[model samples]
Target: MPDSVSPPRTIIVTGGAGFIGSALVRHLVAHTAHEVVTLDKLTYAGDERALAEVAAHPRHHFERVDICDGEALRAAFVRREPDAVFHLAAESHVDRSIEAPAEFVQTNIAGTATLLDVIREWIDGPYAAARSDFRLVHVSTDEVYGSLPLESETRFDEGTAYDPHSPYAASKAASDHLVRAWAHTYGLPAILTHSTNNYGPWQYPEKLIPVVVLRALAGESIPVYGEGANVRDWMHVDDHVRALVAVLERGRLGRTYDIGARGELTNLSVVRDICWLLNELVPAGSGGSYERLITFVDDRPGHDLRYATDPGRAERELGWRAEIPWDEGLRATVQWFVDHRAWSVERLRRR
Candidate 1:
């Protein structure tokens, strides 16, 4: 009941037009008594239509600004004076990162540094008195831990040593370090949450689950890289958004939390499941089976074999646990895409 007891004074969320970011904003506006300011540069991957539901709410405001712009970020901080910040902006595609790493470095590393510098000034200067209650939550990915061995029984915990394998993860790893340094050196109230792969509505088509679903529905070849045996721990977007709010409200500053649902599935199995669900939900396709569209392709460089998260610390310390089962959540997600085919088509066209 913290949302009822102590409403957030003002919360600023970056990358608020992206998939996970949009879901977080919708959840906050619908379920909490907090005012929200969404700052996004609306990159090609960031679609403003994802936030159509709450875009016009009185408590919700949108600002078109890039995080790397120190002046704009500083002005935003001064204008919003947010009690908490959820930093979710980053160039997050592994393949795209491999193709063009400079964008990732500039946005993920330099952009995060810019925000930290502005925050340090705000904490030491005008907002010095209100610094104690101010909290900044940096959203990161579990890919920074690299791949787990097939024989390994343990999951990636908050204490997992950094083993980033891709340009995307390396950039995020740098940002993580910057956040930690700012917290330790300047005593800024900051926390980091590294989460597992997320699957839900509003996801971009480049990701695995969405790619398969969209391709299957469109009767296009569904690409499966490297025999599709690579595994991932999936967490529904709702669960991740809940975990983020928990960290922002009750988590210890200077600490790192790993958020996940512990639902592990291989890429092939995931694609097959999505195909099965679509076959049942939408029966108009030829061959009556979506799996026929599967097409094997070369894997991306530095592709991890597996990823899983150990959320014991988050559960024990923050009293947070993922509530939805993968079966039910995945079904709901598939049905959402089926019901909103036009939206997805338009998104793909724009991309």
Candidate 2:
């Protein structure tokens, strides 16, 4: 809603079937006049149901393609002839990356490089006429900046140095570097963004909020990694998508923006909050609380102590600020999981 009044144009959104990507696609189709071409591999996490609302829209198109498949990506590019690209496809889960670093390397790093190559070719060849107006938004995570001390008052800024601790973070860091390299070395009109933890409806159960909500509802022991003290800045998925659109439309090329809502909470505290909400919404029998099922598990290797970003840059440059309050968003998300129990259960089983 932050002044994205651009003319209707074909915009290619890679990984548009994933959680954040699907949200972005839905917002574009619902609000803007731009035509969207979604290119996704439809991995387990990438579900077409996420985009059900816009699936039948005339301006919305879906193409089954992986970012790593150069020939397939090239074909999509030539066929779509997009005026801009929003690259969101990647292997995103940290735990999965720890179990299988090779997959993360290939998808997050190599796949990004492949997409950058195609964008570069398009800017210089088939899309030469619109080269100056073309934009490539490379979405990334704040974990690439590594951890901040739990007590530190400082937040990650645009100038933060990369110190990725986990395989997923490292892979994204590599991709962020690739996007910048293409922009600087090849003169591509590209911008990068780093956002905080995102949670909302349609989120895969592998994430914290959904897992806590589902496990609590089923009366299962809620597993909390470590002391559940790791802190993260939470931004509602809606707020994050709005920021992304603002950045894509008005952000300066070759620059980076950090997006966050300043909703900081420790892992344990978040689970407790969800339990309380469930107890209030759907109380358990015998007047027992959901917190009784809390179980602390082994901490993940190299888990960051904290992650918070200073959204001052985005606020000033793009006139964007997160509008959703933490408590309100959490309640809404909890209710969403409760209402959509089937989807949550299926995702939990798949995980």
Best by lDDT: 2
**Each model's total of backbone clashes:** 0, 0
Question: What TM-score does structure 1 among the candidates reach?
Answer: 0.97
The C-alpha stretches of model 2 lying farther than 4 A from their native spots are: 1-3
Candidate 2 TM-score, C-alpha based = 0.98
Q: Write the per-residue lDDT of candidate 2 for residues 1-351, one digit (tens) a residue.
A: 543598888998888999999999999998898999999998878889999999999999999999999999999999999998888898888999999999899999999999999998988999998899999999999999999999889899989999999999999999999998888899989999999999988888888888888888888999999999999999999999999899888899899999999888999999999999999999988849999999999998888999999999999999899999988999999999999999877866765
Candidates in order have lDDT scores of 0.89, 0.91
Clash count for candidate 1 is: 0
lDDT for 15 (candidate 2): 88
* Steric clash pairs (candidate 1): none
**Clashes by residue pair, model 2:** none
| lDDT (C-alpha) at residue 206 in model 2 | 84
Give residue 153's lDDT in candidate 1 (0 to 100). 83
lDDT of 1 by residue, 238-328 (tens): 9999899888877988889999999899999999999889888887455769888899999988889999999999999988899989989
